[model samples]
Target: MGRREIPLDPSAGPVQQLAHALRELRAKAGGPTYRAMAGRSVFSASSLAHAASGRALPSLPLALAYVEACGGDRQEWEARWEAAGRELARSPRDDDGADPPYRGLVCFGQADRELFFGRDDLVDRVVDLMGRRRFVALVGASGSGKSSLLRAGILPALRERPEGAPRLAAVRVTTPGGRHTSEHAARLTTVPAASTEDVLLVVDQFEEVFTLCPERDRFLDLLLTALDEHSRLRVVIAVRADFLGRCAQHPGLAAALRDATVVVGAMSAAELREAVVKPAANAGLIVERALTARIVEETVQEPGGLPLMSHALLETWRRRRGRALTEEMYEAAGGIRGAVATTAEDLFRRLTPSQAGTARRILLRLITPGEGTEDTRRPTDRAELDAASPETAAVLEQLVRARLLTLDGCRVDLAHEALISAWPRYRAWIDQERERLRLHRRLTDDARTWVEHDRDPDTLYRGSRLAAAADAFAGEARQALSSPEAAFLDAGTAARDHESRQTARAARRLRSLTIALSVLLFVALSASLLAWNQGRSSGPRPRFARSGPCLFPPRPTSPVKTALPGP
Candidate 1:
């Protein structure tokens, strides 16, 4: 539903107008969502989405199905379709394929600007604020449209610099994900055409520096240095508000944020309406008034629910009929609350058991266990996954295609943090392994650090620390570990056992030596007594002088004749 855009090239021909008219019927019918259409009609949602896609003329039966799903008169729409076809403008250009208005979990990109809506004010504020300041941190909750505002809004706005603005050099946008800082710097530091006015360097998803990057302190130092090295360099980082505290730990970032932070929040109802209606309208489609109100009301309740709203709209779009998204469609897609989870669970259950297990580990890697903090999505390297499973790429691609997981270049991450709470199975997994997961993450960090420090034996786990880690891996959730992590655990356990065995051997050697010395003393004492008896009268030779090493206690070598006088 989310992937289908409406009335592609709507005004071009009667066929296109017929498609446009079809969209309007659905709009009039309270914008029945495409999901609803699929549920109520014989056609699939994808089929329905494609029917109006303008790629190929839909079959008459399909057209009738579309009208029927929208609660329209089939006879009227059927006759109307024929009439439009009579003079149908056959412009070679077809609206065969179109993108959807709602991005779902996908962040708005430069190409998606035309459909990005509802954040005009936020976008303007960001550009205006960063236009003057050298450094500005844009903060917002997850799914608050922060990435969209930066990507679809500010970047284009900067490119469209207005009069009276000072701009000479280039604009460089990059993410500080571990893999790219050096590249970002190399590109960002280059002065374009001898102009030093300002180079706008945008680092989106700045939180990844902590959650995903291994070189946290080093990356931060490099970034801060870049910001300070030139006054003409303007740096803008779009980050989630939850990580603001982590950001503030750095003195330079803290000072910059003290006065130059812009926090994006939920939009008002009017803004939400604009968001819901404007994109479809722009595409020659109408949104039902009731649908708009319903989306706004449901979205506002979830604070940072824009992602969910977008996804729901996407689902609704798929189920959309003639010209509109309807309440029935939204309900069919499980409303705002159920849509994302439903989609995710469906994907999960369809996988084979082995692939499903691989997926769980893959997803668990995507999360950073919060010791005392909230668990959040972690960006992971595809290489780590590759080491774990040969099937990694295929599973990764499937989830990425499903939008449950996203793969950007070599990196992989869950599309949104909301997925953590939205999916029941995911929540259950986290609950069952909270403590163990924390330990697992810590062990992974320690192992990496150990390798970085030349694999020092001193850094290896020992004693209780070793036991706890081993015990954790032996637990039921051990399968959740990546291959390297499992190997690390196995290596550490081996080292511990080796150390314990060496200590045990040393203790045994010492015990044997003590027994040998005691026996030698007894023999020496007996020999001394024999010499004394042979040299002199065999009276109990005057007891040896008392000293620390008395040769032997005063005991007879032979049984005493007067022993226990007939007791």
Candidate 2:
């Protein structure tokens, strides 16, 4: 039996009134113990008991979990919880100078675990899989909170080390890029192997291996080899679902993932509510029920919308009233659909013409247009931009400051893939120049391959392809080309022109030979006709000499007349 709880005075305050209502709810349902309540919800027994303690307002998730376990109407309890939070916010306490609990465009990390909610069940499942498997694939759509699940959810849970689990010597998180190698994989496992303790290596954005990495096969082979050789090494890869087929192309990875894959899908209504309201409550702020309802309504139907919801909540928090995040602020910030667009467009409109152009180039460079999959963020090198230009530098800095882009070391990438579909202006830019962007991407890859082959002439473009590339990259568009790509195009153009000049010279020589042959033939035919005419004249002289004896011929003709009369 549970300990007897103190009765709450309904008239005391909002918190007390809420506690009294919960008690009455329990009574109406024939009063289950906190242990029984915990079995039905994702909360602890003590957490269920604390909701009715009346010492403070319970978090919306906790209150809802309590109500649901007790067979009470969740919508009614959620409203009551929001009211109590508002009353508590109105009554001031000493300021602790806490930072905003909500993460904007960025994902939740281990540091933000206290404010992270809504994936408890998912975390447990992943952690359990990790206990039995050496390789686990966490696949999800873009903006579906897979990264957060890995970092904030699974990382924290692993650190806590449930019951008999082995202690991790190290946890390293890396995103595969253009230059990954076997050596990189060796480095990740070195420490754990030496210490004879398990290590967790999380490969986030694993799709980059296909999109960006040139040594993807070598890298993948090394990771699989490490797992096979080292019993202490564990690998967790978070990849977009669209890349699952790509992973299947690798036989070793396919075998490992057949049974060791965890798929993150859309959040349920209850989960979404916890994701929206719990963070604000942790930061000592009230989220108006209307605002919560509006946010949930906007996000529930949108698949892979966690990032949009987080960004919207962050924007609303910025424009929050003294202690409450109201529906008015959410509307003002443009809600889930408009928040990212509003922020991006407003920044773009403030730039000068040249700066705006630079911004466009920078943003486009960070995106890799899709072939059969959705468009994704492309991590770029700082050296790829024209660092000499002040506008280029300024636009890059401003974008990083705005959190629309992220700068890590010499690499720059879009803050999230959600930005691709969320901002209309950026989407239009991609749509308008998608073909050109694809051409540029191919050129970039070809340039890298050319350098890899020591600039072999056979690798250079020729003929019609060269002509098309030259036309497409003419004028200002050429500035988008990297040094290697520009060099490649120039070499291809020069080679094609040289081939064309040689062809033209050969054509002229053939024309001259044909003219000479025709003249010789005409001369020979004229000579043969003259020879025949001279021969005929020399032979006819004897016949003409007999014409001098005309008189004798006349006498013969008279004698011949007498013979003709007899006939």
Candidate 3:
């Protein structure tokens, strides 16, 4: 009634051995067609047949379902399936040189549109909002896939516009880094008057404007003004949800975001399935159903787990056997929670002592320590790195190759903010030096301000602030400082020392003057007392003399010498 079952050779391999065992179990229960077993179980007939085909190991659930359908012991079959999985994991496989389907700790770009999935509905809603409103804010938590949605979802949809929609003249995306200025905003927001097609501008990581950029208000004003003045200009800004309050500080920007904000939340189970399966399928690979279920179950419970899921999937893909990504590989890659930290720790262990120290400095420099919010990735200029040192450059190269850091032209930053919280060693580094990092951030800002003001003396650190900077940045910590920051600290310290020397000289002069004045005052008092004593002895004498001739002498006698002689 059904196609002949493929014969299995028990001595071939673990897969074949398991397949043969499954067939014997079926025979013991009185052989039945896969269709009959499928009717008794939840799996399809094709899947039941494939489990015994011995082409590859079926997922544990599928294998157990087959066993139970054939009146076999599910517990025994599960053990057999697990044993086969272990044997398969141990077998070495050659690299296929295929590109990974997932973007680990990195946002999807236009080129990755095919591999990006699961945000279809949200993307449509955002596209509709963008079409209706001239300004829209995409708000979501860190690692929530907002950037990926914008780049891989909305950008592609906009380019492939539906019939009767306004054609876009240009679609420009920019991030406002620490140095974004009003001039930069103006350049980004400007629209040609002669151009008839609508222009779409996306500002990704818009929170950076509030956190890093000094001219945040001006940048917001320019964007808002562009929207108000040009009917053809549409602006979308993707910001971390925590920064919505900061955006509200500007009334105009707040009003625009009120009705036009798209919130990216946790992906549903079905969406997560699509996100996990579709990418692997596109790459001609199979993600085991059990692995998919496990990933969905674990990731759904964790808020902001999209990036972690992507990274874990990427790591698992790296360890995949043949064309199948299995649970064994996922576990070997440390699952979702441990995957990132494991990779980071592995890289750290592989580095030399000097290289490890440089790696620490390099990684620490790529983060912007949050004030009231979570820490974020800071894009540093390659020039800012100690690339001159061969060891430092090697560390940077290693990190980039490992996908922990990304190098974009002259800029370098962590591939994602997830790395800051995902890796325990990195997180510990941040926590242990949080106060120092804050001080360094201030020192950096002050240094830039000083340089901008032509190295004004008044801008340099002084007094207690200078002392704090000096203390915190001493020894190895000083290696983290940028050229400008080091220069700023050096200049400030020099100025402070100069002031100290002048104060010491002035103090010495004042002390000498005080001692000299004290000696003169003592000498003058002694001389005045001596003059008074001399005057008293010379000018003042007793006006009366007494004679002791009788028991009672006459009072006030002009001369008492005769009376004294007679007595």
Score every model by TM-score: 0.74, 0.73, 0.78
Task: Compose the digit string of candidate 3's lDDT tens values, residues 1-567.
Answer: 767876778998888999999888888888888889999989999999899889888888889998998898877778888888776664423356678999989889999999988999998898887777888889999989999999999899988995434477888888888675677666655667787787777899999897778887777777886456636677889999988888888888888888899999999999999999999998899999999999999999878999899999998887776788988898877789988897888789999898888998898877778878889888888877857778888899999988899998888989999998899999999898889888987888899899999999999999999999999999978888878899999999999889999999999999999999999999999999999998988985554445544666557748555544554
Which portions of model 3 miss their true places by more than 4 Å?
Answer: 1-96, 163-166, 227-232, 524-542, 545-567
Model 2 ranges off by over 4 Å = 1-98, 164-166, 181-183, 191-193, 226-231, 452-454, 509-567
Q: Tens digit of lDDT per residue, candidate 1, span 302-365?
A: 8778888887777677655557777766776667888788778768988999888888878887
lDDT values for all models: 0.76, 0.84, 0.86
Which of 1 and 3 is the better model by TM-score? 3
The better-scoring model by TM-score among 2 and 3 is: 3
**Candidate 1: 10-residue stretch with minimal lDDT:** 86-95
Model 3 clashing residue pairs (backbone): none
Give the clash count for model 1: 20
The C-alpha stretches of model 1 lying farther than 4 A from their native spots are 1-97, 163-168, 177-193, 225-230, 387-390, 450-459, 533-567
Of candidates 2 and 1, the better by TM-score: 1
> In lDDT terms, how accurate is model 1?
0.76
